[model samples]
Each structure stands twice: as structure tokens, then as C-alpha cells.
Target: MRRKILGIALILLAGLCLCLSLNQADKYRQAEKTYDDILEKYTKEKKVSKKKQDFVVDWKKLWKTNKDVVGWIKMDSGADYPILHGDSNEEYLHTDLYGDYNINGSIFVNADNSRDWSDPNTIIYGHRMNNGSMFGSNKKYMEKDYLKKHPDFSIYRPDGCYVYKIFNVMVVEDGTYPYTYQFPDKKSYIEYLSKVKQYSYYDSGITVPDARQIVTLSTCTYINHVKKRLVIQGYIRQIREYKGMVQKRKINILEDNAFSKTEMEDTNDKEID
Candidate 1:
């Protein structure tokens, strides 16, 4: 009787483990699918143009109209959504009770707490979906050889497309998992980036690289959701201006106009390149 009871217990344990494993896998699959659906919607709404190969974002509508919903997370590809940070408007990780289109994690550039978007080596976060969508595609930057293509790209408010080149991919160190985002000063900011650049998977095409400005997109994965980070690094190559700078800057223009004044004030919003 004792032996028989023991055997039954073992069987139950095995079943429980199997159930948990399957359940976890299903969660990831569902996560992957959710991001895939988002991609489809984004692609269709973007309306691709092979000739120009451009994606546009309307700054005015993004920061204003979508603030309550997704909140200013717009890509040059015409993909705009409100960032679903934490439950509170001040938090970074966002969750939706319904599950669909709800990202259960927060996004941080550089570190989780830092908001300085201008720092180079900004690390962003998201989940890597088994479906190879959303931040999951960020994992592609891990392989050293694959670093050749897959350059980082960005679209700034008002109008601009900044291209990024991959340069680093390293496992997040234990003490540094919840990477801090803010810095005390610009010098420290640049110095810290130098440290991260040392871990770049490759040269990333830019020599004598310095940390002037950058944006990092991060997600959860690896052990305890802290070990691995698929970091795609890049610097802005050039800005594409379809409708010349209405909000311009002194350095970016020759004439003294409204656009130039705006540009000058917004000039601080540059990415590392």
C-alpha cells in the first residue's frame, strides 16, 4: 500500500510539472501572437512605399491625441501608440486587464528609471515573443555576424528619421538588471555609455563613437527576467525632411524663422550618432 501510494504521488507531481510547462509555453505563444497582430495592423496602416522607403509620424497628433491611450511611442514607420507604462501614469511597465494589445512590461531607455532620451547606449526593454514579433525581433541583434544588417532606426517629433547601427549585445549583469535610466550629469552619461560600448558585439560601423544621445528599447526574458537583454544599438545617420523644418533650429538653418527657433529649442532631442 505504501509503495502504491508513493507511485501515485510521483505521477501527480509529474503531471503538475508538465501542466506548468505547457501553460508557460502557451503564455509566450499568446504573447507572440499579440505582437504579430499589432505588426499587421501597423504595416497596413503605414502604407508601404518601396520607392521612398519611408515611414512617417505626425508629432502633433502623437503626443496630444494619443497621450491617454498608448502615449507617444511612435516609430517612423507610421506606427504610433501610447506607451503603456505601469498602472500609474508615472510608472514604466503597463498591463491591460483584457490581455490583447496590452504589454505586461515597461520600456526603459538606458536604465529603467532614467528618462534622458539623449544618452547614448540607451537600452529599451520588451518581451521576446516566440512569434518573432515586437521586442522579440530585438533578439536578432545577439549574433555577432548577424550584426551586419538590422540597423537601429528612429523618428523624432516634427519630422526626422534617424538610422541606427548595431554595435553591442551582452547578457545583463546581475547587479545591473533593472538598468537605471537617468544620470547625474552629461559627463557621467557619456562615460557610462563608453562602458556599454565595450560590450558591443561588433564595431557597428562607427569609429570613435561617443555618447551624445540615444534611445534604448528593453524587454523581459532570460532567467528571473534579468539575465538576457537583446540590445540593438545604432546612431542616427541622417534626418529625412519631407516638409522642411517648420520647427527648425539655428544650427539646422540659414534663415531666422519660426522653424529655426523651434529647431534650436528642440535641438537637444538628438540621438547618438
Candidate 2:
């Protein structure tokens, strides 16, 4: 008949282009197997919750215990990242090119970029990574003896866990840019928090008293690479608890990212539709 109906329409257009390339490789293998099961459930809950918090970080007793800290930030820490607007409603923001977690560049705030835990200056941005991993020990807060030997960084919140006490670290010259992490007022956010503590490299006997609440971690350097931006300021502290309480709530800090780690369990196996 007309070459068997053009060979059955060329084998049904090669079975519909092999079922649309196996459905776009099954949506990047279900976003790489949900980022390797959230990086092996946040590297085994960051080693049993930093050995049950003796490692110390008391955000008013870890946000009053169970007030639901964004289900402790969607696990994984071999360190792959992408939370900035993983979608919308403010889709638990954290920005979409606006970012954090080693995956390079752009942030501005009152930032929750939706790392959501009822935001209040959650302001975060990362990529100080030089393979040590994201915020790559943010250059140990510019070495005033590595900011007194790495001040702090622990954040497990499936209900409780917090500690980010580097208090301040600095280097800001892209035209005095630190009024970010947002501030319409608090007297222009304490005049850009006392001009970013005159660029503090950690004396953090700490006192912002009330910029409402804070957390700022920014990155990008090489002004010799000539672009500048390498900041790390961790303000919210003393919310310690193995139990309950989480107060600051008026959040909408939009734009961001998260969840992931190394080799991602050898390219995260298969079957994810």
C-alpha cells in the first residue's frame, strides 16, 4: 500500500522519540533522587545533632523547640545546593540565581530566600566555597587567627539545633553595600549596623540589640578577581533548647536555596519519576 503506510509512520515516530527521552530522563532522575535523599538525611543529622548540642548554639533554646523549623531545612550536606525559590507562594524562598550552598552568587535581604523558619533577618548568601565546600569556611572569617579558630556553624532544625556565631567578619567596598538583609528603618538599620561594625573580624561581644533579628552570610571575592563581596555575620543567638520555644515570626524575606552533598551517593542510582 504506500510502503505499508510509510512503515507504520516510521515505527510510530520511533515510539514517540523513545517516550520523550524517557520523560526528560524522568525529570533529571527526580531531581537527582531528591538530591540523594537530602544528602543522606543531612549527613546523618550532622552527626547526631552535633553530638547533642554540647557544641553549643543557643538560638533562644533552638527556636523554642518544635515550632517547626522548615522541617530542618530539607536535609543533605555532601553539599549540593538550590533552594532559592525552588518554586513559589514565595515557594519557601531562598532565591533562584539568588542563592546559597556552594552553588555560587547573589543575595539581599531581611533574607529568608525561603530557608524559612519563620524568618527575621534570615539574610543568607553563600559560595565562599573553594572546594572546602560552600561558604568554604568563609575564609575562616579572614584569619584574625582564623577568626579565633572558626567561631561557629551548626544548624540542624528538624525541631531543634542552632549555632552560627561568627558574629561578624568583613570586607565591603562595592560602595558600602551591607544595609541588605533588609532595613527600611531601625534608624536605617542602626546606620548600617554601625557601618558594619567598622568591618568586624570578630570581637563579637556582640550587640545589635534590635535590628529586629539577624543572619547575614554573603560571598564572592577577588577584588583582585576585582568584584568584591565576602561577608559573614551571625547575629541571632541564645535560643538554646533540647525542647521548646521559637518566637520571632513576621517573615516574608523573599528570594533563595538548599539540600545536597558530595558525589551524591554515586550519581544517585535511578528510577525517579
Candidate 3:
């Protein structure tokens, strides 16, 4: 009789575990659908020419949904999502893009960094989910071949779109050099960059000189239960002015005024090639 009772209890425990797993899976599915809806609604691809295409985001529309919507990051490895900024770094650990709670949190920039991307080293953090969402695929960069194949990624902001080339991929303990947000001087910052490159799994042959900004994507790693992080660093390569509705209207009006003996020039926005 005791054996039979033990067997029943074991079966009951297994059933409970199965139910919990299924519930978590359902939550992930719902989270993914929410992000998919956001991507479909606010972003689109514009064909500049037969050979050139531009990825555009309606920043004005996105901001209406959430003022925290800072930018959108895209990579050729099928990693695309909206980036967010909160008052505190811990605010979005379990929050979704729609301000709901979920295990698959949105990719977010460090709260200490400037939202305008002016900081010398901007660090973005995301969960390394088991389902290969968020920054899960960033681990593939450890292999040099994969890094070479997908070397470039783009971040679109209200001001413009910035392209970055991947330069270093490495695993490091938490609270290390990669997490440094401020530099005391130019020489210290340059030395930090050199140290990070030396720790890379393989040299990407990309140099990040002084006065240039870099963005680092960081995610957690669970190797033997040690607290470590996988960091992928990239340097800015190009900057393009956002050519959306506002810019187009401004250009047309300026052209019409030019014919009427009125001269106007936009000296603020410039592209970095």
C-alpha cells in the first residue's frame, strides 16, 4: 500500500512540473506575438533603388505608443527588435515592449547612457533566452566564421540611422571593463578599448579610434553556473539622416521657396560616410 502511494505522489509531481512548463511556454508565445505586432505596425523597408534598400522606422508613431521607445536594432542573423530606455536599468528586466510583464524582456540601453547615443561607449542589455530570442544568438559570434558572415548591424533612431561593424566578441565576468560607462580621460578610454579587443575570442581586424562611438550588446551566460556575460562590441561606420515624412516635407518646401527668391538651407543634419 505504501509503494502504491509513493508511485501516485511521483506521478502527481511530474504532472505539476509538466503543467508549469506548458504555462511558461504559452507566456513566451504570447510575448513573441506582441513584439511581432509592434514590428509590423511601426517599421517598413523603403526601396531607394533597384540595388539599394533602406530600413525605415516611423519614430513619431512609435513614440506615441511608448515614449521609452528609443531605437530599433536589426541584424542579418534575424535579430530585430525595438530598443527601450527606462529610468532605471532594472525596470525592463521582465517587462515587454507594450509595458507588460514577461520573461522575454525587451532589449534596452543602459540607463546611464544618453538616449541620443552621444556616449563614447553605449551598452545595451538583453536576456539570453533559451528560446533564441533577445540576444540569444549573440553567442554565435564566438565562431569567427559566423562573425564574418554577419559583420554589420544597424540601429535606427529619431535623429537618423547608424550602422556599426562588429569588432570584438568575448565572454567576461560581470562588472568588468565592458560595463565601464565613464572614462576619466581619453587615454584611459583608449586603453580600455585595447584591453577589450585583446580579450576577444578572435581579432575582427576592426579598429575603434578615438572620438568614435561604440555600442556593446551584452547578455548573460550560464557556463558551469559561473556568473559571466557575452559581450559583442561594434564601432560606428556610417550615419544617415532619417528621410521620413518630416524631412521630405522640409525638402519640398525649401525647393519651392528657392524658385521664389527665398534661400533656406538645413545645416543641422549631415550624413557620416
Best by TM-score: 3
Each model's lDDT comes to 0.46, 0.46, 0.78
Candidate achieving higher lDDT, 1 or 3: 3
| Best of the candidates, lDDT | 3
Per-residue accuracy of model 1 over 146-232 as CA lDDT, tens digit each: 555544445343444444444445555523632444565556655666676665645554532544344555543574655565454
- Among all windows of ten consecutive residues in candidate 3, which has the lowest summed lDDT? 251-260
Give candidates' CA RMSD values in order.
Answer: 6.8, 19.7, 7.5
Q: What is the lDDT of residue 243 in candidate 3?
A: 53
For each candidate, give its TM-score against the true structure: 0.60, 0.26, 0.86
Higher-scoring candidate on TM-score, 1 or 2: 1
N/CA/C clash count, model 3: 0
Kindly report the root-mean-square deviation of model 3 from the true structure over all alpha carbons: 7.5
lDDT of 3 by residue, 1-273 (tens): 999999999999999999999999999898888878888899888898899887878878988888998999997765799999999989898897778897888899999987866566889999898888888877788789998888888888776677887888888887787778666655666778887776786778877754356889899886689868998888876666665424332211112112112223433234332
